[model samples]
Target chain A: MAIIDLNNVSKSYVSGFLMRKKKAVSNISFKVGNGEILGIIGANGAGKSTIIKMIQGFIRPDKGDILIDNNKPFDPASRIKMGYLPENPYFYTNLTAVELLRFSTSASGMPKQLADKRIKTLLETVDLYPHRKQRLKTYSKGMTQRAGICFALVHDPQVVVLDEPMSGLDPLGRKMVLDLILDLKAQGKTILFCSHILNDVERVCDRVAVMDKGHLRKVFTREDLGNQTMEEVFLHTIEERSEC
Target chain B: MLNKVLSLSILTFLEGVRDRAIFGIGLFALAMMSVTLVVLGFFMRELDKVAVDINLSAISLAGLLVTFFLSINLMAKDIDKRTIYCVMSKPFSRAQYVWGKYIGILFIISTAFAVLTFCSSLTIVIAKMQYTNWFKAFSWIEYFKAVYASFLMFVVLNAFIIFFSSITSSSFLTLLFSICTYIAGQTIEEVVIYLKSANGQEAQLSEFIQKMIDILQYILPNLSVFDLKVQASHAIHLPLDYLLAITGYAAIYSGILMIAASLMFSRRELP
Candidate 1:
């Protein structure tokens, strides 16, 4: 079953003093099935973040519908089982990792004892257990990214949406996140992963969707890639479209 | 629903309390109160009145600073910094987000008031002990009532701040609008009264100006009604009915502003 769906969605943003409407996404539609890992790869301004925001109900679509677990994106119930990590996740700097996780669990209605256990485990998984008591303001960018990972997973959500999850991470941190994604996949959680790292996308994703200039140019599974590298296929697809 | 709101409120409160600016405001208020004690020596008569006025003014001034600085930052900066993405992803509606943030700001204001009140009470006690004769007319009940009224003013003012924050895209604009609203709300009553006086009528203000002032009297909050400083300084008794009326007025005004803010915020697109 499709746990997340978007049908013919379109969005445009008005900018500058003239109030000119610039199209961000035009007539885009796709879905991630239950327990499936789908990766979205695109250059900057390709409407990748816009689609993620629409799915999370942060921004409404200019046209068409988006549903999570059969509920409209605007409904709070649609997000009850969702976890999201933004491109550069910024949290309240005054809060410690534990406090931030505690907030996430409480907001998600997790029982206190269970939440405590889960928070500790997630922090440890991200190698942030030693610094759990440190304020987020004091954390380095890489450390903050790791903390954000813990925050998104603390409630053990059914659907995880990560945008540029590996942006600020070091190689070690990237490996940890890759392992974590694989772990989440093993747990049968549906994942919508957006990243610029083609190698990582090729390694972890069941299917990779290539977006260019606000349009989904191609969605090819691992089998479709066959012996071709994700880098090759992505460049070929973009160049192929630009040639037309 | 309550759980989600409460969680957000607690998170906001924690974030607010830990801000370094709160400490600066607290220190400034304390310094003002301490200066009041030294200035009291210069007043030969009505020393009690001087002390009461200064203490109450210190609390009110500190509250205004908090609303202008910390409260605006708490709500408006979420969107400015994009920290709101982490928050809006939770299973809470935009209305819940507004109410939760409002409640959290109230908690911050209440905590600041509580600390300031305690310090002001200590200063008043010292003043009373040092000059017991002047304090003969000072009633604790009247003093506390003034503080309560001042707090209500902040409640209404914070609602306006939230309302402005919802409409304005930037924190600076929200601060500007809030300060303007407060200034208008504070002086609109006095302006109307002056225009109605016989001497004022002699100036022969235009009909358009008179009509505008009249409309403004109803539109802007009558914040002067919440000023009980003179009554407290003189130990004049306030009727129970008047207290109840202002309390009701604060509740209604804040309630309406919050509802409007929530509606406006819900329609806003988070980019």
Candidate 2:
């Protein structure tokens, strides 16, 4: 069964005094079934983040319906079992990583004793145990990213959504995140992620969805990829869509 | 839901208390309190009035500074820095965000007020000890009444700040609107009274202008009503009924403003 579904979702942003409407995503629809890793590959303006925001209910779709656990995206109940990490995740600079996680646990309604155990384990998993007491303002980019991942999983959410989780990381940092994603997948978690790094997507995704100019061009599965490089597949897909 | 809001509120308060601006404001209030000693030394005849006026003005000035500088930043920084994205993605609604943030700000404002009031009252005591004869008519109860009224005024001001924070896209705009609201709220009653007196005279003011003033008076908060420092300084009789009435006025006005803010914020799209 699908844990997350977006049926014909459409969203547009109006900008400037003239209110010139720009279509961010148009009638895009897809779903991530239970225990599946779906990687969305898109360019900067291809509406990947827009879709994530709608699914997270930070904004509403101009048309269509979004269901997380068959509940509307805006419903707090819909987000109860979900975790999200935004691209370049920013947090309260004044708060330490441990404090931030404590806040997250409370917001997710986790019991205190359980949250304490989970928080320690998650912090250790991200190799941030030593820096847990430092303010987020004092953290390096890699440290902050690791702390962000821990925050997302602090409550042991069943479905995790990560937007550009690999951004601004060195090879070692990227590898750490890649390994974390694999670990979550191994634990039978449903993961939906968007990344510009096609190689990482190819390496980790069960099925890869290519988006271009607010449209979902294709969703390529592992069997379909065979030995073809994701770069070639992604380029060919974009070319084919442009020609059509 | 309450737990989530409380967590956010506590987080916001923690962040606010750690801000350098808040520290600076606190130091400034402290410095102002110290200056009251010197200012009172210069006034021999009206020592009691000088002490109350200087101390109360210090607290009010400190509050205004915090409202414009610190409180506005607390609300706008989350949105500006995109930190709001992570918080909003939680199992909480945008209305909860607004209320949580508002509650946090209230905590900060109240904390600051309490500290400053304590310092001011201490200075007043020192001055009273120095000039025992001058404070023969002074009353501590009346002084606390003024402080309580000032607290209510700030509650109303912070509500206005939250309302503007929800509607405006930029911090500068929020500050601008809040300043305008403060000025209008502080003086609109006097403006209406002026217009009424002019109306009694022959054709001094136009009906349209009078009508506009009347409308403004009805909408804008009468912040002047919260100013009991003069009466407090003089130890005048302030009826309990009047205080209760103004307190009710503040509650109803701030309640409406908060509801409006929550409604506007719930519809706001995060960038």
Candidate 3:
């Protein structure tokens, strides 16, 4: 069964009365099988994050439904099987990185004995363990993003959804996050990531889906993105959106 | 599901405590109740009832003011700063988030009320020698009616502020609307009073006022029910029905407002 599936899904936002509702994702349909690293590329406001939101159950689609492991993705049971790292994720600044990780995993239903052990593992997984005791407010952007990813995966979910997970990282931090994604993929975890940074997507994503103005413009593989750099492919898809 | 609600709500409580902004407002409110000593001597003739009324008025004002201000700012800032997306991405539902925030704000407001009420009572007692013996000299019912009801009213006031904040996107608007509701809601009894004047009956003004009163009483909470000071001051027994009615209304009204807020937040697209 597909790990994540969107069938004729649509979402729109009403600005106010008498104004037309802007459709963010319209009749978007796609399926991601288990263990697939699917990278979604889009310009700003291109509905990439909207797909992740629907899958995360953060926002309900106006039409259609999403399935995770052949079950409704938004159900709490499905959420238990998935992990998500939001773009520019924010956390409780008062908590130390370790404390926050412990809290997140506990909230995800990890047993206390197991949660403590996993916290140690995740700290090393994201390379934030060196500064794990420090409060979040003191961390750099890349550090925070790494911690955010740690929180998402603390439960060892089957599918991980990451939106711009490595956007603000330094070269070293970016490389660490990429290596982590590859590691998670190797562990048989499916990943759906959205980013404008095509190089990282090209390096890690086994498959690629380009979205534009709420439409699924194209879906291809590494070879397709390789036919031209992801930047060239992304620019071409964006231009196609503008033309339509 | 209840655990989800409770866990998320606890975060709201902790977040409210960590906000640091509420501390300043809370201290200021405490000082306001302390300063009511001067306010008491000025109204000393009626002493107890007037003191209870004005002091509760101060507490209701502060609790409503802060709850309305804080809830909106907290929710909006979290979203603006993108902290909420991370939290929401967990197994937490949006409604759970809203309810959790409301619960946290309520905890803060409730604690603030306890502190302010103690200060207000102390202020009232220290103002005059006659006031110190005031409670014991009378039926214990007076203080229970006056002071206990005052605290209860503060709870209702928090409910009002929180409910308003849940629906209104802007904190300022929520604060303004809540204040208007508090002030205008209090004045409704007087409007109803004028309706029964029988003197205003000749002018046909009584019917209009009555109609206005009915509409407002239905739409806005009857804050007067929570004001037991008048009965206390007169040493009249407070009807248990009044307090029960106020609490019942608070539960129903706050629930409606929260439901409305959850509906709004569920549709909100986090930026």
Best by lDDT: 1
TM-score of each: 0.97, 0.96, 0.83
Tens digit of lDDT per residue, candidate 2, span B140-221? 9898999989989999999988999898778898899889888987887777676577546644667788678766675678
**What is the descending DockQ order?**
1, 2, 3
Residue-level error in angstroms, candidate 2, position A196: 0.7
**Is candidate 1 or 2 superior in lDDT?**
1
User: Which residue ranges in model 2 land beyond 4 Å of their true spot?
Assistant: B199-218
Candidate achieving higher DockQ, 1 or 2? 1
Which numbered prediction scores highest in DockQ against the true structure?
1
Runs in model 3 lying further than 4 Å from the true structure: A15-18, A21-23, A62-64, A92-103, A124-140, A223-228, A235-244, B36-57, B76-82, B118-141, B144-151, B154-168, B198-219, B231-236, B259-271
Clashing pairs in 2: none
- Residue A56, candidate 3: C-alpha displacement in angstroms: 2.5
Cα displacement (angstroms), candidate 1, residue A45, comes to 0.8
Docking class of predicted structure 3: acceptable
Please provide, for model 3 over B24-109, each residue's C-alpha lDDT reduced to its tens digit, 9 standing for 90 to 100.
76677667766666666666366665655566566666665566666555665566566777677666666777777677667766
Q: Is candidate 2 or candidate 3 better by DockQ?
A: 2
Give RMSD to native, each candidate. 2.0, 2.2, 4.0
**TM-score of the second chain in candidate 2:** 0.93
Residue A119 lDDT in candidate 1: 93
